[model samples]
Target: MKLLFLLKEGFAGFRRARLAVTIALATITLSLALLGLFGLVAQNLSDSFQRVFYQIRLEVFVDPSLSESDFQTLKSEIERIEAVQSAEYISPGAALQEFEKDFGKDLVAVLESNPLPPSFRVLLKTGHSRPEAIQAVVRRIEALKAVDEVVYPENLIRLLDKYFLLGILIAVGLGTAIFAISTLLIFNTIRLAIHSRQRVIEIMRLVGATDAFIKAPFIFEGILQGLIGGLLAAGLLWLAGDLVRYLFLPGLSVPWLYLAGLVAVGVLLGCIGSYLSVGKYLNA
Candidate 1:
């Protein structure tokens, strides 16, 4: 069986059964699209978790009445803690200015004096953002002499570190289920194509057609359907990504390699599904 003949026969299969081919392609596109969506969300969730894990910082406010030397000593002690990565002193004036910049209002104009205490902007090492970890660190910091308060995003980190981890597990389970369902759908769709052309397949087999010769066209048919489905799914995903970027997260981006991988997976699922269905006839 020449490549050209296989190509011709594979395409002819479509002309013989347009509706079946269309159904197979539609299933492939939908399955691959859903798989791609699940993958995209999982990646974003992981990225957000990592950003919070390494970027979190705690604000350690000291008594504003402390001498400049005492403030320096406080920072030195904080930097020496087991979990502390670094601590930088933020003067009362600097803290006030930063608050003004964030709030877009001048406290000096509203109140006669800056109320912000001089503090240390403290960064923690990795694996220290969990609620328990942060609590221990806070207790230690507050115990230090002259420290007023240890401020951080306690609620936000708790939700992200604890709850988001649970969410990732659920996402993984859901993704696995979706992949199974999609594979089953493709298998069923390819089986239908085989059943519809059972007579033609039997006739070719009787005429001394080698199983490979008979299967070539069907294999190519599956690949063709998968390729078409992949293209359609990719197009839809790209459009959706664009809409999401414009509507909510202006910085959101889908990696190009991941998009390419989705297409490759589509083609792979097509070939696998086709092979499984076509194998049944070879045994018969």
Candidate 2:
């Protein structure tokens, strides 16, 4: 059958251009592996950013003269704000304890009095964790009569926001470069295969073979190369997962779906490369 012949020719093409095929396969594998590694790093950094965002709390210090009843009213008012997730009251005694735990020094023993102010550790909703949102929330809380002051790590949040944007730009630039390089290598590999088989192609043309029939074998060869390279890349990532986790990110994981998608990308790249190369040659 013609199908069997095409398949046979496709596999044979590999032998006809061994070095080119090897270079193409290696290029695809390396490119995809680099992409996978970058993906892992991005995922870990995202997780770390989320954890830091959640830990960003607004320390709402209250007047020491506030009565327990007034404190409860103030707490209710603070919690009623749309952006506020929860407000936990920290009494002077508890604040002193935390200070000692953090700095290893008892303020009461040094000063003979607890100068720590009672405060509400306000956690914002995830949606309102941005610097501008936090600032707006601070403004609203600062208006309350019972609140003496509102403080947060404004500089830290601004720096993180800036860094996150820079990271996105770098990722886009690197990903584009890798994709272009992989496509070029695969295209060159298929072109070399076609050139080496020029005599066979001419003979087939004389024998009344259609362009489709001649192109089918080359396309199949490309798909096969991509398939093999994808599998090798996936296997390499799997084998190195433990080392990656230990050395780079402790909780990093590559999902099966992501690996499957990587394989799909490889196949698509190969098909595209072969199609372009063979079409150009036949047309010329």
Off by over 4 Å in 2: 50-76, 85-130, 142-152
What overall lDDT goes with each candidate model?
0.86, 0.82
Root-mean-square deviation of every model: 3.1, 4.6
Give Cα distance to truth, residue 204, candidate 2, Å. Answer: 2.4
Residue range 49-102, candidate 1, lDDT tens digits? 677765669998888888878888888899889999999999988988898889
lDDT of 1: 0.86
Off by over 4 Å in 1: 53-55, 63-76, 88-102, 112-115, 159-165
